[model samples]
Target: MFKLFLLTSLLFLLPIFHCYSLPEPCSGTCVNAHDPSIVIRPNGTYFRFSTGGKIAIHTAPDLRGPWTYKGAALPNGSKINLKGNQDLWAPDVSLVDNLYHLFYSVSTFGSQASAIGLARSPSMDAGTWTDLGAAGISSDATKRYNAIDPNLIYVNGTYHMSFGSFWDGIFQVEMNSPPTTAKSNVQPTQIVHNSAESAMEGPALFRYGEYYYLFFSKGQCCGLDRSRPAAGKEYRIMVCRSGVSTGGFVDKSGRACTNGGGTVVLESHGWVYGPGGQGVFQDPVHGPVVYYHYVDTRVGYADGQKRFGWNKLDFTTGWPAV
Candidate 1:
């Protein structure tokens, strides 16, 4: 009777003590990814770009393991004439015309004074990045949008750069053929904006099949301990879809994305607290994959130590499921 009681008590306390110990996505010394953007080379080498340390770069064989941190993408820092250019954020890297084009945000936290800068590298190796000043997007007190967290999307035959945060939500503008800069249009069109919550950002657009999917992070991001938000107000991955690439996005509930409508792709549950800062990629083997950075509360709540996460998406139901 004593042995049975002890076993029953241990089983009851197991869930309470080990509930947050779910499978972690990464192995090795890779718990340092924040605002991570991953791109695979032709040879299947995974290059992960992230914020801070002049946009830290990491490479790994599989998403689940053995990530080795190479040095910063721009070790010498950015040439853009902006305050705190060395402490870059939100790097969006894409392979264009045999060159890796990297777009990063140059700004201070919370202030609207920001600019998105560009850099290029032939192979994404450290010490190969050449800063190209600004990519034609700048923000100030007078502007309605904050120029940060850039995500570039190529749709149809035109190239578009989607960016913005806090002040406006999300916006996109057309880029030239080379995508060196946004067109001379002074303003970008808004794609997704939550006038009520007013806390959407990190826009990533992916075109699959007949629809264009817009994935973004919504609610309060960061400060999980210092300034933690209410339960439902924490960061989570949300998504919407549009038939065309130029706007008219709607959620799975037939609600427009402009008015604070987004279907949740991944949210805080179990130990996955505030999973966001997401980007969608078409993997060579997994087809569609969504990668993001989420704070693992079982670890620490510091912003820079967030965990890098990825999950294969199932779109057979016309909506993406993890």
Candidate 2:
């Protein structure tokens, strides 16, 4: 026939031109599975929020997902009066003007008194959750900064939040409503100030073209010490960019995240150690993807513990670098 129907229509348009073209690097199941937060709902469905603190809703009428698991929108196991000791850590979701706001984090391990919490789900649809309590707080360890990883950005209408970890880096605040009730003197600024080698935490924000990306992840995460793979520098997953979301923020060899810059994006080739707690979304059609958590080192723990390992992210030049 006409040259086998033009080689089967160029092999189905060559995977739609390799799914929207980018710098490329993520080769198969995109890390197979870890911390991936790709949300695309307006009636399209594709939600992913992680850290085991809960929030994983994957529904796909499209966006190429055989994906269909709509469970755990976070009401799970419950316990949060504060003093730090609840399981849910690092869960981020954002949607204002139409409701659905879920930002989570509450800690107690190497404590900086961590706390960042809020929940609501009018339309990510599954259970229609609601738990608006303690949207921000970092308990005062003399107060430099260390309020777990929470990310939400609205821009002109104001939602702005970028949390912290390790007591002295990555902070930003602004929220009046959309579920969050109070906090808007405009005061929590310090964009990025990590060092010591690398101890920065996860903070993700995005806005391409004019540039406003601020994806974060830094060294030393979880470890079981099955010898040495997941125990050294904490973790990896670095990236910096800023036309101005409140930063000079450069990396991708440009350097200058205050003085650290960070550019690796995603590390650990074989065993998968500290991949870092990260977040980035867009799945209306698989547009931009990144979700984090890693340390599968081999997966041992019963006290043999080496918890949390999840993945998916790839950007490469505009520089998500993972």
Candidate 3:
């Protein structure tokens, strides 16, 4: 009887040990360092960029951090900040032609005024940042639309960016300059449009096998109580796959993403509400991990304060199954 009681107690305590063994006081080291942009350098270092108007460097000999923060990857206050600027939002980083290019969003939050700018860093080390200047700007709120969430991808010797916020859904632009050059004629084209079910934003693009996967977040972000059952709204990470980079993106149901084809890749369960601003990276060892943020619906937390989290990515059937 005594041995059986001990075993039973151990079983109950096992769950507590497992849960508590994870990290605590979720911060930059956790995940979703705001709007995370992750990249791996040739030397096997992983760097992350966030939307706090600053880029953070996470260096590890391995894919996983026990990852350390070096500092901002770009010079402070490099934005033009012309009309109703809201610091920096989502940043996309990539290396091309032996140089590093950082594309980021400058927008006015609730307002439509927004722009996408470019910066360069010779190396991933701290303080090697340089201001390359604005790559493109929207003409006005309506026609020009909100220019945000910039992601760069090189395909067949052509540099392409997936970006947009309000008005049209996610937009794509081609870079005329070499992947390294910050100055380019980014001609905007509508690739994805909004739907009635949700408003889509924060697009991250990646290609695996023969399919081009566009990973995006939809619905309200921030607000800790936003995902409460009675809240009547949800923020989720959704995905669509296409044969072409420009995309005829469709969901598992074969519905176009322009018509709300986004199938939930990650979502709020319990108190974990994700207005998924995310980045996908090919880890040298772990394969690929989706780094993103979510609202920790855990009790006794302040409003608008969300926690960051990361999970090993699973790609089955050409979709990013997180």
Q: Highest TM-score among the candidates is held by which one? A: 1
lDDT (Cα, tens digit) per residue for candidate 2, span 1-322: 9999999989987743212222223321222233445556776655655545355555655434455566667645334576544466667777776777877778766777667878777686657877666775555577788777777787766667878876567887776756374374567777777676637777888877778878777765554353343344656667788887766888778777767677666666555555667666654444566656555545541212332333335554576544
Model 3 per-residue lDDT tens digits across residues 13-109: 7743211111123333644367777777777666777776365566655544566667776647555565533356677888866777877766665
Ranking by TM-score: 1, 3, 2
Q: What lDDT tens digits, residue by residue, belong to model 1 across residues 268-316?
A: 8786888888889888876788888887778888887788888888899
Q: What is the TM-score of each candidate against the true structure?
A: 0.91, 0.30, 0.82
Question: How many clashes show up per model?
Answer: 0, 18, 2
| Model 3 bad stretches (over 4 Å) | 1-28, 61-63, 83-86, 180-187, 225-232, 299-305
Better of 1 and 3 by TM-score: 1
Q: What lDDT, from 0 to 1, does candidate 2 have?
A: 0.63
- Cα displacement (angstroms), candidate 2, residue 182, comes to 32
- lDDT, model 3, position 116: 74
**lDDT-based ranking:** 1, 3, 2
Off by over 4 Å in 1: 1-24
Of candidates 2 and 1, the better by TM-score: 1
Model 3: which ten-residue window has the lowest total lDDT?
Answer: 16-25
